[model samples]
Structure formats: structure tokens, C-alpha cells
Target: MPLPPTVADLTSFDLLLSVARLGSVGRAAAAHGISQPAASSRLRQLERRLALTLLDRSPRGSTLTETGALIADWARAAVEAADALGAGISALRASRHSRLTVAASQTVAEYLLPAWLVALHAGNPGLSVTLRALNSADVADRVLSGEADVGFVEGPAVPSGLDSAVVGADRLTVIVAPGHPWSRRRRGITAAELAATPLVSREAGSGTRGALEAALGSAPAAVLELSSTTAIKHAVAAGNAPGVVSSLAIVAELAAGTLVAVPAADVPLQRRLHAVWPTGAQPAGPARDLLSIARRR
Candidate 1:
């Protein structure tokens, strides 16, 4: 008779690897939808069973020790093999009904996803989609936790445990009320000049805010932190302060002359829009189909 696998053998080694990669026990627990203490105890149990330490823990973060690094490499190989088998099985079972849930940052949700959704629906009438609009960080979190089938964000980098591909491009444009000083200037605005002026901005965690911070070297003089792009545009138009926003979001305002798009010497600030999904979870069925539509658009 074959010997039974031990408790350690039954524990998911994949979880351990993911925790190492993400660098925080809390984040890892959230990704798996378990309590932090449970995750910690499991890791300890695994360590005790293996007679090896896998992580160096400090308040700063966790890092894989030497033995952990070696084990992690092997674990990754096993995960790849398992994923391949799972993919083959999933492909075989593709005829079954499956739902796709997608979460997108506010700008993409407001401006881009509706068109993509219409196209996706035309192509796959049988597929159901649930769409949620959130900030970029929340979109990534939902994808990593399996709560969202896919995510679309505009930002600097993909959060750990989620893979992202740039599906489109967008630009951040500085705008002012038609009467503002910069509206008539038309050119010669440097980064320093923009920095010195009081700016209306989105609150922290917004993808637009992240892009602006990256371009401007620090947080702007946020005279007002509004939640919605529409609200920000209204504030700018009321002459509250100059604001930066996605070019797509302010299209109607620009066209109607309610707001003026200021020209900066080197500053049609461009940013890449990304489509993201969990690193190990391949897009399938409706999710795969939607991704294709988004990419083409």
C-alpha cells in the first residue's frame, strides 16, 4: 500500500510561494481570502514539518531566505505544470456556462469599458458580465483575489501577483477655466511652473493622480481633492483652480469651451492603460473574448 501524504504535504505550497512573492502576510491572506493568523500558522506548520525556515520576517517586509528561494523555484515549476493541466481541463469543459466579472478604474469604466462591453456582447451573446467601477488599486486587488475576472487600470506598474499588459494609451492634460491665466498663455509652461501653481486634483489612489505625481516629481498643491472627474471638471470650470485630468474625460468640456486645455512645452503627458488578471489564472471564455475586443479597440 502507498503511504499517505502528511499534513504538510496537504497544505498548498503554492500559497507559500505567493506570499513570498507579494512580501506581506496580510496581502497574501487577503489574496487567498483567509485570516492573517491562519496564514501565519500554516507557514509555521510548514516550516516545522520541513525543518527549514522559508522566510525572513520583519516589520519592513518578508523576504525569502536561501532555502526558501530554492524551494520557491521548485514550487514555481510545479505550479506551471499544474496550471497547464488545469488549462487543458478547462478548455475541454468550455461549453459549460461561465460568468465573467470585471473591475475597472474610474476613467476606464466611465469612458472606455462601455464601448468594449457593447462589442463583447455583440460577439458573445451567451456570456454574462458583471462590471464594477473602482480605483486602480481596488481593481488590482479584486483581480488577485479572484473576485474579478479581469481588471483595467491606468498606472505605473502592475501590483504583485497580477499580470498586466498595456491594452491602450491615454494622456493627462492640464486644464483651466476659460478665464484662467494659463488659458491664454498657450505655451512655455515648465514642470516647475506647473508645480508652483495651486492645482485641483483627484484624491490619492486615483490612477490620474498617480500619473501626475510621476510626471511632476511630488504631490501637487492640492487646493481641492475631488472624487469624480466630472466634479473636477466642474471645479476647474468654476475657476477653483487649474486641474489635470484624462483627455478622454474632459472631451465635451473642451469642445464646448467650458474648459480650456492648456498647452505645456513638453507636456501632452502620456500614460499606458493596462488590462490585468491574476498571474496564474489564464483568461478564458468570455474574459478571453473581452480582452481580445479591448485590445483591438
Candidate 2:
């Protein structure tokens, strides 16, 4: 098996993950503060070195191949681990000054952190922020271990050893392709009806999956278990299976008419998004400010 690209060959795994997430080199480049052509050329170079087509380029956008999708997930994990290592080193060097480190689950990291970080910067220009994106369990671990000044999670009760506050709410909604049978129904479907159907669901341990299981009182027969909201949306839009997802994750698809939210008899499967930190510790300055901004948003 040939390698896709060595770490040395790419400036950062951030670029690759961004391309995977956004599905366009131009968008990925812009997110990373680079030029579109530069991003395209780098991806092409990686493809050449691997001797495999990593992306399916179409008029609408780029889509990852099966292998590319798997590789992208691994790359994202590696990149996140690298970031954690760097933050650890920086913390050691700084020793005692005020710095804010946050650990957040994927949904909050992707959809909410950027705006919160922006607000934090504007409110306190002198403070530094380090953000880590992980699953709910890991977020709690980081806060407990003091690796993160604060943690945000989308799942159930906060893990022990941490103090938590509900900063916001997220609703889990069932969605299907616009042409799917469920979309034609004006009346909401019962939980039993949904439980009998095949569904695309987040993998176990995901905040979304946990909330859905709580809402339905049992897991639906999963046709597919995906890691990212984007992949789940694409699978649902292709009519593979109906999906339970955060409404925030599917806003673009719903707006574009690519997917439709199915009305559930138990509407708005509510989940509290919590901001957590050590039980005895207080978050002041930037961390406090970021939490305040997130609540307002």
C-alpha cells in the first residue's frame, strides 16, 4: 500500500481536513488563509504521489472517494492530536500567566467556536486561546485533567469532577431526502414508526446519537453509522437512509432543498449544550468571556 502523502509533504493536516469538510479546495484554502490555486496544486501533488484519485471533481464541488474519506478521518485525528501536543508545550512554557484553553465536542467546535473565539478576542485582546475538538467524553477528560480551562459538550449530564452550566440548546431532528416517502407526510411520525425504519445515524458515543436514543427510548436499526454530520447529510440526501442530526448541521442542505426535516410526534429532541470546568475552579477573563458569548449566540 502506498502512502497518500507524508507529513513533510503537506504544510498541515488542517488543509486536508478542511478540504474534506468543505468539499472544495477554494473554500478550504480561504479558511486557511491561502490561495485557491495553491490548495488545488497541493492536493494534486498528493494525489500524484499516492497514485490514486482522492477526490471526485464535479461541476458542483469535490467529493471524497471511499478511501479518501477514511484517510480524511484519520488525518483529522492526527491533526487534532498534534494540536493538543502543541498546546501542552505552550502551557508548560507559559507556566502561570492567564491563558484560555477549551475542549469542545465536534458540533460545538465546528458550528459555534469560531464566533465565540472572535468575541473573546474582541473583548480581551491580550488573552490567548487554545481550542481542542473532541468527543463528549474527551472534552470532559480534558477539563478534569486541567488540559482545558473549560469544556463544552452536547450530550447528557456532565461527567463527575466538573462543574457545568447550560450555555445553549440544540435540537436533534430527523431528516430525509426531499423525495423520500417520509417527506410527503404532513403529520408527524410516531417514535415507533421511526424506530422500525432504517436510518443513518452517528456512531455510538456521539452526542447526537445519545440524544436520539433517549428521545426514541431505543436505537433505530442503523443502516449506516457515520462520524461526520456532512457525510450523514450526503448519505440521507442520496436517499440511502433517513438521518437524525443537529438542525444546525443541516441548515445549508435544508435551505438548498437537498433534504427535508421529518416532523416527529415528539418534536424538538432537546439537548442541553453545557460549558464545564473544574468544580472548584472559576473561569475568568477570556474563558469566561467566550462562554458568555456562546450563551448569547
Candidate 3:
């Protein structure tokens, strides 16, 4: 859009402000890459439109008249506002071009993604990000199929056809209510015993579920199957049954003794948490910035 007639564009006002600083109309015009005659004509037209004599023109150099000084002050404010508007629009453009989509597993989404996202925003304030929470298998699929710009998952292995970095580690922990028998045991539970016990568990295909299955070398006995980590945590805390879940998901519960972590001494339940992207298409822009932050941790 064009500026209205009363204000002859921000540049004219900018030149007005500059002449007051530069002390010479010729030098102000030179600084702005315009001829002195053009600058003089622009100021003349501005004064004519406002019906105000602004500059005290003389042979020595141009100086602001009493009214001219007040107008210059007002023009300075307009120029400052226009400069702010330009910066805001530039940020909007940056965000439009740097949009990012991220897919993460339930545990990582619930426990870890927020901090990384906050850091990403702090480092690149104009970056635009969208987040999706899915199971590890689904997160990998989305990244590999180009449905997402980046992905985070916790699993024994990264899915085929995707490149990944091991950003962190998580362990599958068997947790039970404080009143449960497992909580009272001095000895750690064996993998076979854990598999034999009926437990509350996530539905199949989640990285948390996969990690438990791999540790036991078979499917676990589940008395109830839930779709959400929060539900499973609630069910376990109610003493209905023990549940195998990520250590990351149970920090508060364990700290409060609402749920106790059972030592699965012989189970190799540790899994690598990864940041994955499409096989040959490396992450760039905001995705690259986010991945770089995760890699640092």
C-alpha cells in the first residue's frame, strides 16, 4: 500500500530527520542516494501539502524553524514506526519460508520435546514449527515418507530407509504402585517373570511397547491395553497392575513414591532415542537448527 498524501512517504520524513542530523540539505540528499534538487523538491511539496514553512533555508546550511523542529520530531516518530513495521513484516516472511514439521513418539513428546522446542525458538525466533505425537513406528514412517521434516523416536533400532542420530537414551522400566508386591521385593525381577506377569501396557507398535517386547524376547502378558501413557501411569498408580514404561515418563511419580521402579536386573531394556529424517534428504532450515540443538545434548 502507498502512504497517504499528508505524509509524503517514510523516506521523505527520513530525509527531514536526516537533514536535521546531517546539518546540510545537500549532504542529507547525498547520504540517501538522491540528488539535492530532488530532496529540496520533496521537502517543498511536503511543506506545501501541510501549509507549513518547515526549513529556514540559507546559504550556510538548512536549519529547522520553530515549527520545523516540532514537525521534524513528529516525522521522526513516523519514520520509527515505519521501520518497526518493516522489521515485523520481514519476520513474518522468514517464518513463512522456514516452516518445520516434527513427529515424535509419546514418551519423547510428553517428556522431552518442549524443552528442545523452546531452545529452537530462542535461537531462531522467526522459525515456525508444527508438532505431532505418534508412536515410534509411526514417527519413523512419517519422516521416511516425507510427511514430516524431522522425527524423534525411542527404539532398539531406527526404522529402515531413514537416517538417524542417537540423541539420547531411555530405558524400559517396570513400575508398580507402592502397595504392590513387586514394590516390596528386595530382589530385582527377572525378564521371564516380568513377561509372565499380567501388566497394563501401551497398544502394540509404540516404541515403549517394542522395547519391552524385545527385552522379554516375546509378547508381554497384558491385562489391559491402553493408548495413552497418562492412562497407563494412572492405572499403575491405582495398584490395578504393574506397567512397563519409559523412565522419562515416570520421573514425578517415582520421586513422589506414588509408583516404584522395579529393577529388571537381567532385561536389556535400554533403547536409543533418535532424531530421524528422510534417507538422503538431510534436514535444512529450521529442521536443521532443531537437530543441531538436539545433537548438542
Candidate 4:
């Protein structure tokens, strides 16, 4: 059944219950943190909507009439139910505030999340955080399945059925062992040539592979499909094959001369990193805080 407009405002009903208990509109208004005139006006509006004379108002005080007392009795149950609902909502919010589950792609997990998590914990010392490092596709799956409160993904496009914001950007690097023939090349490699050549690569479903495929406009020929940037780096450094990975992951190797960056002039190697959650459901509590830290950096 549709609620009548007058009975729709729970606060007004709550005010009536207060007036019934306190025996004075002025006293009830004080309890509600409103002035006497405001309280009286609300009661008058309620009475007009219900078409009942609820209060016997006197110069000395106010008292509920028979109809008013009956209505108050019914409203009491509803008020109690509303209180329970408020309590349940508070409990859920507190739980979320104190605990967070996050799923992130390898690049974000390895190179980015440490700083973000540090800042998140700094602000929320009591918060318990769990982090899962997976490929981009798996991160999306975890978020969609409600296994994670929020997810970070590195890909050219966000997965369907998730809402996202670009928290950061990264560029893919093609690296080779110092002895590889590509290391000594004077000019940048074109996308077609890079695609035609077999390279060490991250496995399918990883953001690094997805971005490489998107940039080349076709899947690059892979000599081996390893799962981690570390594995790809080790393979490339051992002269197995050239590998494509995040520039963020290769800083130390590049500086140490173990790996050399091979420029891809025609490929769009840059990709955005996203923070994602279930569609239409905005992140709150600790999840929101972590997202803020990611974007700020």
C-alpha cells in the first residue's frame, strides 16, 4: 500500500511520539533540537494530513487525544523498526570502514600499491587490508564477484559491468639483453616489425599483454608466455628473447645495464591504470580512501 504523504515523513512521526511521551510540544521540540514553533508547525501539518485532532493544546501544556494516542501506538512500532534499520546500516558501514579487500593487476600491485597502502594505513591505523595481486582480467572478476571491495587494473579498456576512474598511467617498454641484436639498433622499431618478431611476453589476461596487443593492433608473436614481469625480465636478461613489459618494472634493470629499452615508434605503448568497482556502486570507506591516494600519486 502507498503511504499517505503526511505519514511518509518518518521524522514527523518521530516528533509526534516525542510529544506524546513528554506531554508538551515545547519539551518535545527541545529534545529534537528544534524550536517550539517548528515542532508545533510539524504537528499541525501532520494533523491536517491525517484529518485528526491529535493534541489537546492548553496554555499550560499539551496532551494526546484518544485518536492521537492510538496513532502514537502504531507509530511506535515503526519508529522502533527505523531505529533497528539505522543500527544495522551503521554496523555495515563500520565493518567496511575497518576492513578492505583489494584486487590489483601485477604492475599496480608490485610498483604502485605499496605507497598507496602505506598512506591508507597511515590515515586509518585500525583498518585491516588484504591485497590480491592478479592479472587485469582476474582483478575485474574479483570485483564483479564481490570478492574484493575495490580493484586496480592496468589495461587499454576497463572490463564491462564495472565503473572506473583513471588513477594513473604507464607506458610499456620493449627490453632486450645487452647482447641481443635489437639492443644495438639505431632507429625505433615499427609496430609491424615488432609484431612480426617473437618476444618474451606476459601471459594472456594480463594488462601488459592486453596493452601490447591493443597497441600493435594485433597480437604480438610471443616466444614464451611468462606470467610475471620478473620472469619476463629474467628470460630477456638471459638472452631468451626480447620482452615487452611496463617501464615502471624495468627501472633497476635498465639502470644496471642488464636490460636495454627498445623504442617502438609506431605503437601506442601508453595505457591508463584504473580503479574499478561494481557498476553504479561507488566505493566508500577505506576503498574510497585508497582510491584517493592512488589518484593523488
Clashes of each: 0, 0, 0, 0
Per-model TM-score on C-alpha atoms: 0.67, 0.64, 0.67, 0.85
Clashing pairs in 2: none
Candidates sorted on lDDT, descending: 4, 3, 1, 2
| Residue 137 error, candidate 2, Å | 1.8
Which of 2 and 4 is ahead in TM-score?
A: 4
Candidate 3 at residue 132, lDDT?
Answer: 96
Candidate 1 vs 4: which has more lDDT: 4
The whole-model C-alpha lDDT of candidate 2 against the native structure comes to 0.82
What is the C-alpha local distance difference test score of each model?
0.83, 0.82, 0.87, 0.92
Instruction: Please write out the lDDT profile of model 2 over residues 1-297, one tens digit for every residue.
Output: 764446544454577778888878789999989898888788777777667677888888777788778768877767787789989998875653457888998889889888888877887776777889887888888888889888898886677888888889988888999888889889968888888888998887778887787777788889999887888889999865799988888888889999998889754498999999889888765677777888888
Regions of model 4 farther than 4 Å from truth = 4-7, 184-190, 278-282
Candidate 1, residue 271: lDDT: 92
Per-residue alpha-carbon lDDT of candidate 4 for residues 1-297, written as tens digits (9 for 90 to 100)? 997786778898899999988878999999999999999999999998899999998888889999999999999998999999999999988987899999999999999999999999999999999999999999999999999999999988999999999999999998999998888887968888899989998888999999999888888788899989899999999975888999999999999999999988878899999999999999988999999999999
lDDT (C-alpha) at residue 137 in model 3: 90
Error of 2 at 31 (Å): 54
Clashing pairs in 3: none
Compared with the true structure, what per-residue lDDT tens digits does model 1 show for residues 30-132?
A: 8889998898888887788778898898988777789988877877876777778889898757643356789998899999999999998887787778999
Better structure of 3 and 4 per TM-score = 4
